[model samples]
Structures are given as C-alpha cells and as structure tokens.
Target: MMIHTEPGIIKRDGVYFCSSDSFTQDNLFYILWGAVYSLDSPYRVSRSYMDAFMLQYIVSGELNFVLRGKTFTAKANEAVLLNCREKNLYWADRQAVVKWFHFNGKNTLPLLNYIYERNGGTGLFKKNYTKKIEPYIDSILNEIHKKDSNVFSISHNIYSILCELSAPPAVLESPAEKTIREALSFIQSNYSKSISVNDIAAHVSLSTYYFTRLFSKYMHLSPHTYLLSTRLEAAKKILIYTFEDIETISLRTGFQSSSHFIRAFKKANNITPNNFRKVFYQKSID
Candidate 1:
C-alpha cells in the first residue's frame, strides 16, 4: 500500500512474510503490515479501501478520521479500527505521532466486530484501551525492527493485542437482572430467526408491555430496536465477508424481504447494501 505524507511527516513501514512452519500453527491471526508515523505539519491520506484490518494508535497530538460518513477525532492515548473494504480518510490536525498495524486472518473479522460493537458501532476506542494495547504493539514492532521472521512470534503478539483490545469492561448487575440477561442472550442467539418482542417476552415469562419497559430500562433500547440492530449487525458481517447475493443475505439475516433489508441497511449505514459491496469489492480488485 502507498501512503502520501507531507514534507514534515516521517513514516517507517514494515511488511512481514510468514514462514511455512509459522503459517501452519498461527494461520488464523497474523500481521501483514506495520508502521510508525510522526507528523509536524498538515498531512492527509485518502484511500478507497484496504484488504486487511488496520488499527491506529495515537501517541501524541491528534488525528482526525472520516469513514463512511462519520468523522472522529483521536487524541493522545486514543486508538481506532479501520475496517477492511471501506472508503476512509485520516489526517493530522496539525502535529501527531502514531503507531499502526494491519492484520488479517481467519479470526480477524470476529475480533474487529467485537471491537466495533463494544464501542457502540463506532471504530474509535477510548484512551485507556490504547494504553493497554500499546505494549503488545511495541512487542510486534520490536520483532520487525530486529528483522525477526518468526511468524509465530509476530502472530502471537498480534493476537495478544487483539485480546487486550477486545476484553469487555466489567459491569455489575442487580439481582433482578436475570430476566434482561436471559433476554439479551436469546436475542444474540436467535436474531437470525423470525422472532419478535412478543416472542422474547413470552420466553422470559413477562407481559409484552412490562418486558419492553424492563428491556428499555436496562439495555437503553427496546427489545424491538435491539433485535433490529442484531440483525443488521449480522447482515453487515455477511456483506463484508461473503459473496452471497443480497437477497440471500437478507433471508439469512431474517429480513422479511430484500427491499426491506435494503431500506433498513441504508437507514443504519447511510449506504445501500449493493453500493457498499460494490465500493469495497472494486477497491479490492484494484
């Protein structure tokens, strides 16, 4: 990949090749590219898409990111995930330093999805998260700096970094939370089925009205919205990782019809499903 930087910026990039033996044991998670960048003047990057997941951590100063249609500012000790197969742009506000890694394998998407969902569907993670994962990134970079080709070592470090980032924050629940927890678990497990709030209420032995209120109180979303978001999330994963037709994906994600799925997806993502796939796939081909 080619990145254009302004005159005052400095960038050091490393690309890794895994050996056959390392590939056999740690093929599911590995790094493809890594870089450290420092900018003292205005700098910007525009890319249609990338074929691998990218994580950028800000060491100092600030960086601004625009993806799909959302803009985010990541300051010192902040990090962000740029999903594969999407149009995005990032630039230094004025001066910044960042460490970045590009990684992909069998387990990459799931980890990325976990991070995305945890951050409320936004790619930006909080500063404490950046602090936690920085050491793991440094370990990976150290291996590359020493010209170590031990793919297994690099892969392990990458997985460690992901594990650190994906660890869920602990939350204490009241004893009365059993119903909501069970309801949430059910939705997560059965979002691909033709299930409704009534069904969820019945499963939890509560009246629909009471159940809806309880769910809304604890989850900050009514059961209906939660189900819709769950289905949409599934559809997004399929859209990114599979080549199945839109109708097939819609059906598989429990949408009643393709048109409904398209409208719902557009409302959530600001882009139609076909256009999303087109932009991403076209960039991959190029």
Candidate 2:
C-alpha cells in the first residue's frame, strides 16, 4: 500500500496485521491491516492501489473520498466501503475520528462490487443508515488491540458484518419489493435464453416503460444491463470450470454468437474470454 498523507497534522492510529497464510485461505476473511485514527481538517491521502478492501466507519466529523474521478462524503455515524485496488483520494473534510480496517479473502472483491453497485456507485453508506455494524467493528478493534490473533473469530465477525451489508433494508415494504424480487428471480431463472424488457415486464404484469423505470429505480441499473450481467456471470463460471470452446460457451450463456460474446466480455473486463479463462482457471493451469 502506497499512501501519501498531507504533512503537519496530528494522527493517532491503532493497527493490526495478519499472517500471510491467512490471505489465501478458502472460506475465510482476514484483516490484512487496519488502524483507528484522528485527523485534522485538510489532512489528505492518495494511493494508486492497495490490494484489499478498506472499510472505515466515521466516529466523528466527516471524510470525503474520491475514486475513479467521483467523490463522496461520510459524516459521523456513516461508513465507507472502498475497493482500494485502484487510484483513490480521501481527506478530512472536517476534524474527524475514524475506525477502519483493510481486509481481503474469498469473494471479498465480488462482495465489494455488490455493495458498491447497491450504494449508488459510491463508498458512503449514508449517515445513520448503517449503524448496525458498529458493534462488530468495535469487536474488530478489540481484536486489533489484542496480543494473540483469534483468526477464526475475526473471520466469523467479518462474515457477520458482510451479512448485515447484504441484507435488504427493513424499510423496503411489500408489493414494490415483491415486484423487484419477482423480477430478479425471473432473470436469474431464465437469463440463459433470449429474454427482453418486454418479456420481463409481461412476467411481472407491468408495462414495459414503467418496468424499466421501476427496475432502474430499485436496482440502480436497467433490466437489460442486469440480464447482461447475469449472462456474463454464467459465462465466467463456464469459462473457469469447463474447457468448452468460446462458441459453445457463448451460446450456452445467451450471447448471439462468439463474436458478440467476445466483444462484450472484453468491453466489460478489459480481457478476452480466452485470456480470462487462462488467467483464472486454476484447474486448467494445474
């Protein structure tokens, strides 16, 4: 992790480091490093990348984050879930006290992406809206301050926090939530076929125009994009788990042709299907 901080500010931080072996374990999440810090206004940091996710909870005051040319703010009682594997900037918008951790493990990156998408493409989780995990974070801080590491307990707590993040807010009442849920189920069930906005709207008994707007409002993405994503995920699994050729895989994943599949895959992932398989298919490599 390369972090450049503005000079001439008081900073107090508590941090923890886990063993290198913890990073590669299956079904386990481990903190790589973390610290609780207090910073003054105008204090800032910039990093090209850190190979982990950073979860920071603002205990007091506010922090502003900049990622991929967009900025968001987290005031006291809010949280920041930053996928730090890219260039980013953050600064104390006011005097601030924050508890934070950096962690990575199985499914962490994908989970971070999920949260980011649902968060309206920002790191801030909205003030007072996600305070349920504050206690879990405090437990992590207690672990950080300990002499011996309880890796399993920390992993369990981290997963618990993830579960909280994954839960739909209790405020999402029925009918509307029911509609989105039904739509999601349908897409998941039939993404491997030629389904369209009209088909989905008809399935939910909604007008095409209304369904499109409702889906975007609830899902933060158009139904078409969501369907594309589902197909891409299916294709990725096939690529990783099977040695099938691109044309067959594309057809199985609902793409019109290998050419279209290749184009879409490359556009989304910046890597061709063949290369993605070669790079990520450990079974093949083995």
Kindly provide the TM-score of model 2 when superposed on the true structure, using C-alpha atoms. Answer: 0.56
Q: Using Cα atoms with residue i matched to residue i, what is each candidate's TM-score against the true structure?
A: 0.53, 0.56
Clashing residue pairs, backbone N/CA/C < 3 A, model 2 = none
Summarize candidate 2's per-residue lDDT along 1-286 as a digit string, tens digits. Answer: 6776655246766566666363446668888777888888668888888788888898888888898568878788998777888888888856889889988887887877776666566766754455788888888778867778777888877878777776544464589789999999999998888788799999999999999999999999999999999999999999988899999998998888899999999999999999999888665567
lDDT of residue 89 for candidate 2: 84
Q: Pick the candidate with the highest TM-score.
A: 2
lDDT of 2: 0.82
Worst lDDT 10-window in candidate 1: 16-25
